[model samples]
Target: MFKLIIMCLKSRSNKSGVRCYQNRPSSISRSDGRRSRFGFVGGDIGDQNMWRSRPRQIHINRFPPSSKVDLRAALPKAVQGSKGEWAVDEGPTLRWGIAPVSLMADDFAAALSVLPEQHHRIVSCVAAYQSHALAFAERHQVENVYTSFEDLAKCPNVDVVYISPLNPQHSELCHLMLNHDKHVLCEKPLCMTEEQVTKLLEKARARGLFLMEGMWPRCVPAYHYLRHQILRNRLGELQNVRCSLGLPVSQGRLGLYGGVTSDFGVYGMQLALWVFREVPRSLKVSGRVNSEHVDIAADIELCFTRGKRAFIEVSAERKLSNQAIIQGKNGTIKMNNYWCPTRLITEEVDFEFPLPGGDQVPPTHYHNRLGMCYEAEEVRNCILKGSNESDDFSHNESLLLANLMDTIHAELGVGEIADRKQIPDLQRQIEKVQDIVEDPEELASETCRVVQDVSSGTLETKQQEEEAPPRSKAIDAP
Candidate 1:
């Protein structure tokens, strides 16, 4: 009789704090130290006595259940095959990795809930904390849990990594993943600056690796239908887009990225850009900022080519309609919950694109999060087709949105809270350098060089100070 040996690799805590065992098969060794291919020991192939004398360390469970049996139960029916399945020859499966399981965790989970298991799998996860990684792993049935982003990037099994860390960390993480030759799908805003966005895009292109901003709105079925209609001039002489998105998030939650602009405003900006398909001619921006230099609200007016324009309002301190209206000479297209839209309305028709229903819905903080699966599907398709970016949310579009955010932030004078925190340190360093370098011309040159190097992350002011010659002074005589 063939015997199966089960080994408990580890017991990890799930999201609910329940400990679960991760079991796998282990090979058994014979008394003479020879390995047994079939996990059996002893000299005879079918000796019952030899099988009984097998190493006690090996727990033989003759009818051991498969580890993946309960995996489907943890996911919704959408991923469990309630929806249509992919064909057997669809393509190679894409193994996915996710990092820093904090913000957008629900959205990722929701997307995975709807993605077909055969085509994609959440194989690895990385979190800043080991406990968080373990919990996410147990909850998602992910096979690997890494506490470092670098480890996730280095994982050979992970073909793609979805980065959803804080806004400021997006660029650095993207560079790390891209350098490792792993495809990246980052959540918006892709970066705090247009320059950063440009560098990331260039790196991705040069490396021939896929990179995309997880702008799920662009992948929504309703948005696709709306874009097709506008392109066909069904709306007639596109005039303007008016969009507003707001939620009463606390000041503490805004963190260093500041207020609604980077957090919520990018949605409206991208929507207008998607509609116009061109950069704006000029911008008129107005907003409210708190004492902490965080932008609490913003209202922007974008002037596009041919006298077309878009107006957007976003708020982090208060709640607003969160709806969008696109008006043209002939008719109007209105979207409900425009950011992650499921419904669109026009004069003659009301269109609804509902989420794929299942007995269990994945836990998510945002509304209509299951709709994110569309974007996930798009990423898979793009990767399979050997494309680096999605046509719906191309790199150029992301750059445009980043530039618009940079302009809006500059206009409001509420730069990223993280950047603002470094202002005093930079100013102090400049003053110190000025004291050390007496000549104005030399001072100016040195300051410019150091600042430029610092901005590029190639040098540090402290190191420069240490390397500078000691200040010379004439000794006073009495």
Candidate 2:
């Protein structure tokens, strides 16, 4: 029932790099004839109809952190103290250094804003996009904006680095951070291959430093509740798991290394693997691969040896309900936005509705949505306890995820970029910026000389300090 139309120019690539043609959508129409603040249209009638027709349901149960179960028991034993309790309180307040500011970085900042002041502090911001980073720094009041990633990596006050750059640069940047002995909490899809994950994780382990993929859902209370139910067999024998997450972006292309599977399919895979706690015996996949050789839409089926199956669907070309359902012999668990689940519903029926006794978890404002802090807390606890990786979302899981995705790409013929290094050249660009910063006086004269050589063309400058509009677009996850 939810509908969105995205207009995109045909994508083209050569030896140079991926080139995306941009053209705004000429019209956005909702069936109910309503428009949002961003001029996107939507309708409540279609939403209500879709919900009423759904087989399962979801409910939000609100509970304070104090009422929640002890997370220590769910975490790895290495993060436990002498009494087998989490040593969360023993650690110093986490000082975060956010690099390569973008939309996701802003999301992290929003999540950090709600955390307890004593638990965390954002000490610095490092930006490669000069214009955008300068604007972000002024808005967030971040005083230290370093041009060099090395500077942020070496800053003694920066205990951890939150890497939120584009996908291609994740591996290189993470390697850089780990080489400097800085704990890292990187954005999802940590790297392109399991080999990369293994290498970086090995480095973290060697240094006795903490490193974790920012899988926030795994750390949220809602997911914890679901995990308890599955582990306890509250849903009876597991039968099937289904997940869907779809959205429209510029011409339906996520980026160079981004498509439906890389950008959105990871959520479905993580959910399935976490629930089953086992790898599938076989996998079957079919999808639409775009001109750029990235999956535009994917439907994957993973068959387990125990007569169980998991079906996952993801896309960057349309809008879906964006929910997940786990089916079992006795009942089903339905999760809305399973990637960042805020609601959970247990229904004890195959065809009949109206269950008698079922659990419904209420949502917490910060914990449910902007809950990156939950992962941060886990990282802090692990660091204080001297653990190298989180048990909840361990390196093994990351490797599994990467390997699974790699298989999907192979089957779909989602060929790797011919010149992958040319795409998302953040490292190269940042090096140039760093060089300019390291020798500002010489670069200034050089810049003036270049300007003088350009035929004395007058440059227009706006003196008024107008606030840059907030970037509302959602970037594909790394």
Any runs in candidate 2 off by more than 4 Å, and if so which? 1-90, 348-368, 417-472
**What lDDT does candidate 1 reach at residue 11?**
45
Clashes of each: 0, 6
Structure candidate 1, residue pairs in collision = none
Q: Residue 279 of model 2: what lDDT? A: 49
lDDT of each: 0.63, 0.60
- lDDT by residue (253-288, candidate 1, tens digit) is 675554678888888888987677555656788989
Q: In model 2, what are the clashing residue pairs, if there are any?
A: 60-361, 60-362, 61-361, 61-362, 62-362, 188-478
Worst 10 residues of 2 by lDDT: 427-436
